[model samples]
Target: MRVVAVLAVVVLAAGCSASEPPPEDPSVDFSADDRKVTAEPFLYCDVQVKDCKRDNTAQVKLEVAPGTPVLVSVPQEVAETPWSVVIQYRTAAGEQMPPETVATFPPNKSSTFEALPPGDGDQLQTVEVKQAGAKLVRDDKGEAAAVSRGVWSAQISPPAA
Candidate 1:
C-alpha cells in the first residue's frame, strides 16, 4: 500500500511539472504547419567584424512539404539590423541551383518573412539570413564593399516522394 501511494505521488508530481510551458529560445525561428525549428547564429561577428567565427556546429533542420511556404521570424535584435534572406534550391534532377536573395529588409522594417519553395519540382534546400552592418569592407585598394556581418542558416529537407 505504501509503494502504491508513493508511485501515485510521483506520477502526480510529474504531471504537474509537465503542465508548465517550456522556455522560449532567442534565435531565428522557422515554422511550417504545426512544426517549428529554431537555429542559433552559425556565424556571428562582433561590432569590429573581425572575429567572424563560431566554434559550435549549430544547425537546425526543418522538413517542409513541397509547395509549402516556410515562415521565418527573427528576434528583436535581428529585426533591428539590416538583413536579407538568401535561398538555395535543388532541381528535381539533383542539380544544385543558384542561391537568390529573396528579400532584403532595412533596419527595424521587418521581423518576419516567408520563404517560398521553388515551383516545378524544385525543392528548397537551404535558407540563410545575412545581417549587414552600416560599416563597409575595404578592398585591396581600400575601396568600400558590401559584406555581411553575421550569418544564420537552416537546412530544409523535402519529403520523400
Candidate 2:
C-alpha cells in the first residue's frame, strides 16, 4: 500500500511539471565545422497583437572553416511561423559577396536548413533567420509586405590563415 501511494505521488508530480510551459523562450541553433552555437532572438514580436521587444545585447558568434556548410535549426515556435534564411559571404580575397535569401519556408514547412557557402572559395560570414509576422501592409508600389516578427542571427568568423 505504501509503494502504491508513492507511485501515485510521483506520477502526479511528473504530470504537473510536464504541463508547465518552458522557462525560457525558444532559441535558434547554428552548427558548422563541428561547432555549435545558439542565439535568442535579438528582436521578437507578436504581430497579431502588435507586441514587440528588441534587445541589442544578445548575439551569437562562431568560428568555422571557409567553404563549410552551416546547419540552421529552429524551434517549433519559429517553424510554425513563415521564415527565411539569408546568407552573406566573403570571398577568399576578402571581397564582400552580395547577400542572398537562400530559401523561404512556409509555416510549419521546415525546422532545419543547410546553408551552403557559394563556390569559388567564398566563406559564410553571416546567417540570419527572419520570421514573418502575422501582420501585413502594402508597400509604396501596392505590393503586400509581411512584417518581420522575429530575428535570430549568427556571425561566422573564418579561420585565421
Candidate 3:
C-alpha cells in the first residue's frame, strides 16, 4: 500500500509540473484552405531621377518598415569645375534630416555617394540633391550632364504571437 501511495504522489507531481509544448517555428510552412504562409524579408528601392544637370537637382523617396536598414547611391560627374554636391533626407514627420556634403570633383570624373537608413524606429525617408551653390544648367549640346541615384532598402517585420 505504501508503495502504491508513493507512486500516485509521483504521478500527480509530474502531471502538475507538466509544461506546454514548444512554440511552432514561424519559418515552417503552413497551409490552410490550400494557402501557404511563408516568412520573407521585405525590401524595396526607388529612383526619382535618372539625370541631373550641374545647376538642377533630383529627388528620390525610400520607405521601409521601422527599424529596417537601407543603402542609397548617387553617382555624379563634375568636370574640372570646383563644384560641390549636397544630399539630404526627409523623415516621415516632414522634418529634414542633416545634409551630407561632397566637396569639389575633378572635371570629367564621376563619383558615387551613399547613405544609410535611420537607426530609429521604422519611418518613411526621402532623398534630395542639389549643387553646392550654382543653379543647375543643362548644356546646349542636349547632353544632360547629371548624376544618377539609386536606393536599396530592406524591412523585417515583428514575429507573430
Candidate 4:
C-alpha cells in the first residue's frame, strides 16, 4: 500500500509539471543598430505670434530606426493658425531631410503625423518645425518652443502585423 501511495504522489507531481507552460525567451529579435525616438509626456503650450498670425505651435522630437516606419503626433491647432506647419527630419549631421506636410488642424485641437523611413540606408533621425508666414515665439524664458496646452504624446514602433 505504501509503495502504491508513493507511486501516486510521483505521478501527480509529474502531471502538474507537464501541464505548466514553457518558460518565455527573454531575447529580443531586433538588431542592435535599430533605434527609436519618442517624446516625453508633457503639457502642450499654445504658441501665439503677432507677425505670423499663428497660434498653438508645438515642437516634438522623434527618433526613427533605419528602414522603420515611425508615427509622429503634431499639434492639433495648426489649421486655425494663419500659417502652415511643415515637418522635417534632421539628420545627426545637422542636415535637414525633405519636409513633408502632414495635416492642418484647427485651434485648440491635436493631430497625429506619420513619418516613414526613406527606404535608403540612412540612420539617426530628428524632427524639425517650420512655420509658414510666422516667426517662432519664445515663451517666458523657456528654451523649448511653446506647444498647445494639452497632454501631447509621440512614439515610434514597428508597423502593425
Superposed on all Cα atoms, the candidates' RMSDs to the truth, in angstroms, are 11.8, 6.9, 23.5, 17.8
List the candidate numbers ranked by lDDT, top first: 2, 1, 4, 3
Q: Alpha-carbon error at 128 in model 4, in Å?
A: 3.5
In model 4, the runs with Cα more than 4 Å from the true position are: 1-48, 51-63, 75-110, 129-161
Clashing pairs in 1: none
Q: Write model 4 residue lDDT over 75-104, tens digit each, in one string.
A: 334324432233344454546577554444
Per-model TM against the reference: 0.73, 0.79, 0.27, 0.31
Q: Write the per-residue lDDT of candidate 2 for residues 72-159, one digit (tens) a residue.
A: 9999988998899999999888889888999899989999999988876778998999898878899899999788888888988877
The model with the greatest TM-score is 2
- What is the lDDT of every predicted structure here? 0.81, 0.87, 0.35, 0.39
Clashing pairs in 3: 52-146, 55-135, 55-136, 55-137, 56-136, 66-122, 67-122, 79-107, 79-108, 80-107
Leading candidate by lDDT: 2
Give per-residue lDDT, candidate 2, residue 114.
96
TM-score of 1: 0.73
Off by over 4 Å in 2: 1-23, 139-142
Give the better candidate number (1 or 2) by lDDT. Answer: 2
Q: What residue runs in model 1 are displaced by over 4 Å at the alpha carbon?
A: 1-26, 138-145
lDDT of 3 by residue, 37-67 (tens): 3322121112233332221121222333444
For 9-128, candidate 1 gives per-residue lDDT tens digits of 999999888866743324788888898988888877764577666735667888877667788899888899888999998876778889999999988999999988667677788888
| lDDT at position 148, candidate 3 | 29
